[model samples]
Target: MRSLLVTGGAGFIGANFVRLWARERPADRITVLDALTYAGNRANLANVKAELVVGDIRDEALVDQLLASREVDTIVHFAAESHVDRSISGPDAFVETNVVGTHALLKAARRAWLGDGARRPHRFHHISTDEVYGTLGPEDPPFTETTPYAPNSPYSASKAASDHLVRAYHHTFGLETTTSNCSNNYGPFQFPEKLIPLFLLNALEGRPLPIYGDGMQVRDWLHVEDHCRGIMAVIDRGRPGETYNIGGGAELPNLVVIDTLCRAIDDAFAADPSLTRRFPDAPAARGLPTASLKTFVADRPGHDRRYAIDCSKARDELGYAPRHDFASGFAQTVAWYLANEPWWRAIRDGSYRAAA
Candidate 1:
């Protein structure tokens, strides 16, 4: 695509996608539209050379204006309210942003870009999560592209609704669209509220590492860079009106993941013992030690037990393969958080703290 519109480009995955696309194809023009919510940060795109538009995706007039004025042929939509815990506490924002906002963007895209007979070249790529498939039993196979959506939480339900809207727009209105449902993403620039980064940051800061329920919930972790590459593959080669499952194929239990993080943190501190004294007053840094900070909390309502994706469709169709194994990806991720404290520190101590 020559000129593209990236919604939620300041958010974690969106920002990574923007950075990747910008680096991979420097000649292409990009315009980022983000609401700058708690999860969205302009610093994520500090080095990007694309145009940055700070606005909500729900603004029909603004979305239309951008699509028309920028001559955007491709729209990579990544905007959504993603946290399940936040959704439980306040679901209205999820409905408004994920469902209604997607509708508005679809309408605007149809009106502004597809109004003419020049149709085949235009595309709308929707980035979604695998939670739409609900929890999977240990004996069950991974979720494939054909899996029926059985969303349990408000967040997943809202994403499922948005997916349906994208499909409807393609079938009824003939809007060229592609949807990709991805597994859990963990990598650089992720907000600290997420499981990996939360535990990592909390462990580093000598705070309690909270684990919901018994911490056996399983998630298939995909590196954010791999996810961005998968999205690029889908946007470039995926057939319109098709849904692809993008997965890292690495599944681990929640508690196992936490323990892995603890070990990583221990090694990190051992490499530089001075870090232990950096936070003198924190309990995790004091008598209790890091591993002892693990605290199991009451699970939230409707928490999914397991989610895994069958991404053979993407691998077979788009020639997409994840290069980083879990160990490598997790190391890179942990290093990023350790190296870039200022980026996540503001969010951790600011408005995003409530979600944490």
Candidate 2:
């Protein structure tokens, strides 16, 4: 069985990837390294069977130890300061983690895997964002792997730097590497700070669902599961030193997503009367449309106008296709949040961090 070390495996998309990998490759030994940051909750992996090492990725010594001790053949680097707002407010942390932390991992991998006279068989798959390609105009085509990066936000800029580092390691050290720049992802175990989860939770508590600007900004939404699947395909079949773009094929404006989410919540309450009791404060609980809670606010600085990914490369090369449509995916997301109130509630009230 191949041993794999997943960095940031306790975070939202990372946790989802870990769970998927465990289920799909039962024989593979999985090790997770996370700093247990605010977004990286250990509880996110409560049901998944894997070794969890609570440490920062910037710790090069620790990474080298894990690489040598575990005899890890694959490294899925997912750790990053991902939130745009957080990066805007504090770019230092983003640079330190995304750029510096990634470099540390690369160095450790190079020392452990390539230090010997003979080259080793290993893969370093870096997870990145389409935001690195910057905003698109209304009539612009979706971003491709060949698109020249024009990162606007600090978070995306940091990710762009890390991507370049991964590429550099491949060309300079002959380290086998690949990168996947994915569109927006939404699914279970997501931190509530993101748009979908944050709005969902806010609506449940009678709080206004804040929409930035005109909410016309468009994005291609990829289901986290599909993204994990795409990653697996890349690890298994993709050529070394190449990049793939994974997208859900669900490109819609932010307003449309919010409207759909609101309608989904309303439908959930209507279908299950018990939801009214559970989330009594919700507009749906009072027989009012969940859309009643929408409150448009001022847009954040440097907000990207649009982001779309052209996944034709992945589709043709790796037979990768997103299985979840926005409708079914959004419905499931709403249902997940409803069924796991305690999980998100802990996060919302700051109890999860305290308990951690």
Q: Top model by lDDT, which number?
A: 2
The collision pairs in model 1 are: none
> In candidate 1, what are the lDDT values of residues 156-195, reduced to their tens digit?
9999999999999999999999999999999999877789
Candidate 2's TM-score reads 0.99
Which runs in model 1 stand beyond 4 Å of their true positions? 116-120, 281-289, 351-356
What CA RMSD would candidate 2 show? 0.9
lDDT of 2 by residue, 1-356 (tens): 88999999999999999999999889999999999889989889997889999999999989999998999999999999999999989999999999999999999989878897767789999999999999999999999999999999999999999999999999999889999999999999999899999999988899999899999999999999999999999999999999999999999999999999888888888899998988899998999999999999999999999999999999999999999998888888888988898899888888888745
For the record, the alpha-carbon RMSD of candidate 1 to the native fold, in angstroms, is: 2.4
**Lowest lDDT block of 10, candidate 1:** 279-288
Against the hidden reference, what TM-scores do the models get?
A: 0.95, 0.99
